[model samples]
Target: MTSHNPHGHALASHTLPGHDHHAAERARSVADHAAAVVELLRPLREMDRIETLPLSQALGRALVQDVAAPLSLPPFANSQMDGYAVRSGDLSDGGTHLRIMPPVPAGSSPQPLEPGAAAPIMTGAMIPAGADAVVPIEKAVPDHFLDPAKTTANTPASTAGNGNGATVRLPGTAAGTFVRSVGSDIAAGERALAAGTCLGPAQLGLLAALGLAEVTVFKAVTVLLVTTGDEVVEPGQPLPPGKIYDSNGTLLEAAMKQAGLLVRRAGISTDNPAELRALLRTEGQGADLVVTTGGVSKGAYEVVRQAMADQPVDFLHVAMQPGGPQGLGTFDGVPFLGFPGNPVSCLVSFEMFLRPALTELLGAPARRLPLRARLSLGEPGGQLTSPGHKHQVRRGSLQPDGTVRLEGGESSHLMHALAGSNVLVHIPAGVTELADGNEVEVWML
Candidate 1:
């Protein structure tokens, strides 16, 4: 039977033998379904699921606890420049000549500066205890450091001054100049990173600097992806009449992987309830969640709904465009989500339901970036209308001038348009008509 919906689209229904009419009639709001998904996946964030991984493998994983610094950065007082280390009092008489002592290269310790004497200290070299200031080599008379072998230790400033002498002229400067004090960058025992921080390159670098070879992070959730439909075939196979390639498998798998979830494809299952039930029981053994695409609608060949009718699952319609049919519940003791078959609908369902739920529950994948931009009609005098009772998600390109222009018509099968879009423009459930320059919420892809 077919009936016209409020939006003037034909709503087709088919009653298959042994179908549960109550499941097909069930409905839910998008927010309610989202919350249910979060609740179902909450166990993945439990403490027992956390893992201790090496720093090299911890990138993009959420840190489960605070990482305290083991030691202060730099660890010691050092020179910030390659210059002369001297006591400020030695140059008290305006500019005075000082005997050049041995040079202090980086990583080498040096003795305290003698009275009225200076030492050539290289950058990052430990500063002697008595030296309180450093004057760059360019500020000195010769503007160059003498070889440490040629310079004598503890050469006095008054010894035989003049050309080729051990003494050199120096300028007056303040104390504590060009010195890198200990704990300047980060103090010891300080919190380097707090809990729930997504470890990235800079965070991992800090962990390495803190002498941490490994870190504790939340374990990635394992998802069993099952794309159902007898008409669905692999991409490499020869196309049979009235059959289509299985895009939901690749599309959803990539999306889940990008969100840091380990995905295992169960291949394609025909519209046989007995076969799908056996497949789920087998493949969902160790999976944290089971996600299926297609067969959740009110059609006679809805394989997922037919197979899961006796299980604890709900087949419902959400107040949304292009992707309204949804399935959420437990199957074979694993959390399950059934998405629409259309490629764009499957992706949108993941983004709207699973992605946010993961962020809220697991804290691994970061939330999508949201922005508000003026809506730009693609053509002159073009107007867009959204169902007042359903939230509309449209593909759009966020322009440099802060306007979001529609990429294609509001259709779920437009894969090319989805690829070209940089953002998903949101029209709220209460909104109906929108003109150019109207502000709309957009989520960055």
Candidate 2:
């Protein structure tokens, strides 16, 4: 039967038959529940389209297409040293001292070396023809020369010259020493950066080396955040009785920023159905996703549930402690996730469920931040027990040698414990007690 309330709203006591049996049957393992949620949201997920962006703006973006070398790197056969540039056939015992021709500096056109002659070429100068190797000035004696009659007055005679316009050279100094062959680093039309690669500093440098001014990359996700609670007060505000400073807003915002999402909005909302509805329906426009915390449970003043009552929402009790109540739905065509109000619960819920799903949909690497470590302290036989329906998350520290020391209490509202924690220990359902030194799976925050 349906009854009309004071506001003429129809209310029906929709109860499941055999409530105890339903509760027993509805409970599931953590893995099974997570898999079910993922499958449910898979159809609604979509990655953004690719766009071409300049190298300066492409940081933290995923590559959309393979980057091929436009031209061969080090496009020409150039000298790698500051000595001389010569072909590799002119070496002889008691090195042949040929009259030095005009010098070839860098950025000059390539000129063929005269037969049996050498040119004084600077480093990075294109190798000339005829001569085969370079003889560093340090190894060559500047003195041997032809007869004095053959010396021209224009020749600035070397101080070591014997007045015959000749220069002495040492043997074995003309071996293959400093020449970088063309295409030594990369060849033309070769794939330098593969498709689906995430562009970082090194990747950008490689693209720049290949002369790419711009590249194609996937668009980044934009998110909106709505923090909810009537007992919450903003930081720097004087806290009144029965009120506490809001921590979830700041913590969740920072976490989203660290995950590379552009957080468009983050603010606290009271338990007012009308105000919450307006924010959800209007404030989240143009956002790919909307996240909220609190008011999703069966409480007397749970405004979020009241606001979204007629909306398409799938409310479920996930098999995870401190973050059991979860709400997944689409509002105004944007995916919305409502997390538990507790600060630690909000963060843990994001890491365990939402983060992995979003990363997969955005073509990002999945969050596999698990660490294996031995428990350092023993727990009383009855202390570590949890209901069979939920996975309990506990705060812990991973010691230097891969041992885990449990930190503060496991309550979802304990922000101090969360602040001191570096890892979240995941105790699966049905595991009542674990002794010290047992291996546990942890997610490093």
Candidate 3:
């Protein structure tokens, strides 16, 4: 009862007996594989691979080092009101009429105020040297600032002996009132942002305020993606009998890109071990990692296992359903990962293994949040039984009422069911069955 895919490669359906026979050989724990991946990519986090990117392009990137404020915010002492800048000593007893100097608008610096003179100042204007406080325009007698256009070019004298027509009556004001002192917001030379801070809108805004046009961050990992299996063909092609459209390539590529990895798809490879090996050699030269889907199972036509046999790849099974078959190792000095061909399995493998490792090492593609939710009545709790030896990751929808409903059955080929899921329910290997209203751990996608 041997079945073949369109290209004459042995299909898994025809080799189920062989898969079961070899499932136990070279098996690795999920935890061990995750740690291995993290170790493999640890070198990519080296300081030599850091990139200096412009503030505009640094969003979502983690800072490589601490950034100090180049200058104090509001760099200079300035008035906070469009009113009169006066020496507090002048208005000691009560309200008094004082000679008004030329108006100082925003972005302008003014001369020192005389002992009995007030300078008409606009918001954000620099305070005169002798001024200690400001009176807002509304609180002043005239309730307005002097018009700059009306002031004559002849420099008015600050001496009380000279005649100055413009005068303003201001109430006694306290020292340091309504003034933005130097370093009021942030002091110069202080740490503005700490290392490993993820650059978001507010962070980039702060960097811009710090007068930094660029920042240093970790470089993105470049992945070479290759999908395998003779039964698979790209979309938009006329499908022959027993052939299926390729979804693993698009699925894994999108997932990797969304995780902030620079992905380069090397196209699909067939069941020929020599062809796959040659393709990896040609395309995996400059990549930080290489990922291939399918051909890692125990079937006779397991091309990835066959091609990577002499390359140090360890093809093994993880204690998990849907995505139990896994492969990891190096191909010509480049880190390689091989996942199963099923679309759901491929995606789940990425979330379970690669994403967490990337988040831990490079600090990109923020980690998925783990939460606990009760099973809803709609969920088939009675039938949700998993083997006691393997951890099960089930697709589920988190309801608005804080409950989770299973999206599909345990089969890994339920692509549409996975599409409708918003969370991944985790069933530990020790727990064999779940009941309605039981609290379960889930990862928010």
Candidate 4:
């Protein structure tokens, strides 16, 4: 069965049937096909469900709406320095002495600046409406504006010079000097932050400065996770003969959680097609997407491959190492994604394919940060490749000097080595080899 999505894109329905002639068809590049799948699920993005969250709890979530500044930063003109606020026009070429008003502490409202007058203002204190410039206390003729040097020297001459009816000599300053004008940081009624921005400490701080206590953000995507294999057993259970603890349950679930998705794991499914299909149908009803690790290859006991056989899925061998077997399609009106059984392959598939597509659809952060770094082999002159394949990703450790050393051999089952590495080094197809210290693209894991 095949149909078109709401956007009219061709949504083919196929499955892995013993690698027959139809299964031999190649596909577009990984990027190309990944983008196509993302577009196909464009309508399922969680952006439509928006909720208001307090700014205190909104960090690390993407904002669903543009936030306009409610009030200008510095809401009133304020002093950026602990000094005297003055009108630039009140100062002469040599020096102009101005009568001082009462001190303006940070919390007190400052009196308006009169002609040929100045106000003692503390940092963050509102500048009198008429003041246009601020003279640092240290720069005043008596030099008393609380400079560290003046304070350490026990200088009382600074304020002592401003006795009754006394005028303080101040040098000319440019208008707006050391004065934070209204909306200097952010203007009232102007856009403070655009939508789709992931809020961090600084971003939330800006919103808080604009007096926003609550913000709106999109709902997180929910995934129905299924880990398969008869040999796969839960971690806490007693080990039976020929059974190993299922790490995919831990691995993929943690990955999905880190990607800001809601993950509901179906636990381990034995190698039974009927049981797998029933479990998928039971759990997948409420999920926006369905993901299964293992049982996606051509093995005889491949439960996911068998369960999704009748569904509209195209299982293929993508031209990539470790993560070759790929299956994805719409099943029961929900997007179903299948990944290889290997722990490393499963994680890599999420990073390379699902992360980008999901983040692009929902405007979330693409946490897979790729950096250009030098590739180093164990030996002085060495290279690595997956032969004819266009891209081979290997576990690697990025050294302090900005070179990545391959962690272990190119085996997908080496979960220990994968755990020890911090990055994935990409060796493109065209380059058959690379001498030690050759440049390559490194994805920060």
Specify the highest-lDDT model's number: 1
Q: What TM-scores do the predictions have?
A: 0.82, 0.69, 0.74, 0.84
Candidate 1 lDDT, tens digit per residue, 317-353?
Answer: 8877767888989997788998998888899999999
Worst 10 residues of 2 by lDDT: 1-10
Model 1 clash number: 0
**Model 2: lDDT of residue 245:** 89
Ranking by TM-score: 4, 1, 3, 2
Worst lDDT run of 10 residues, candidate 3, spans: 1-10
TM-score of 1: 0.82
RMSD of 3: 7.0
lDDT of 3 at 307: 96
C-alpha RMSD by candidate, in order: 5.5, 9.1, 7.0, 7.3
lDDT of each: 0.84, 0.70, 0.82, 0.77
The count of residue-pair clashes in candidate 3 stands at 0
The residue-by-residue lDDT of candidate 4 on 1-445, one tens digit each, is 1110222111234533432433224633567657756875676655466778898777667877788888888798888898889999889878887776677899888778888778888999988878998998888866774333332223345443344454578988899999888887888888898887877789989988777789898777789999888788899999999988889889999888887888998888878988988998898877888899888777667788788878898787765665778888877878889899889889988887888876776666545788988877778656564434345678999999998888887777789999889998887644556677778898887
Error of 1 at 171 (Å): 6.3
List clash counts for every candidate, in order: 0, 9, 0, 3
lDDT agreement of model 2 with the native = 0.70
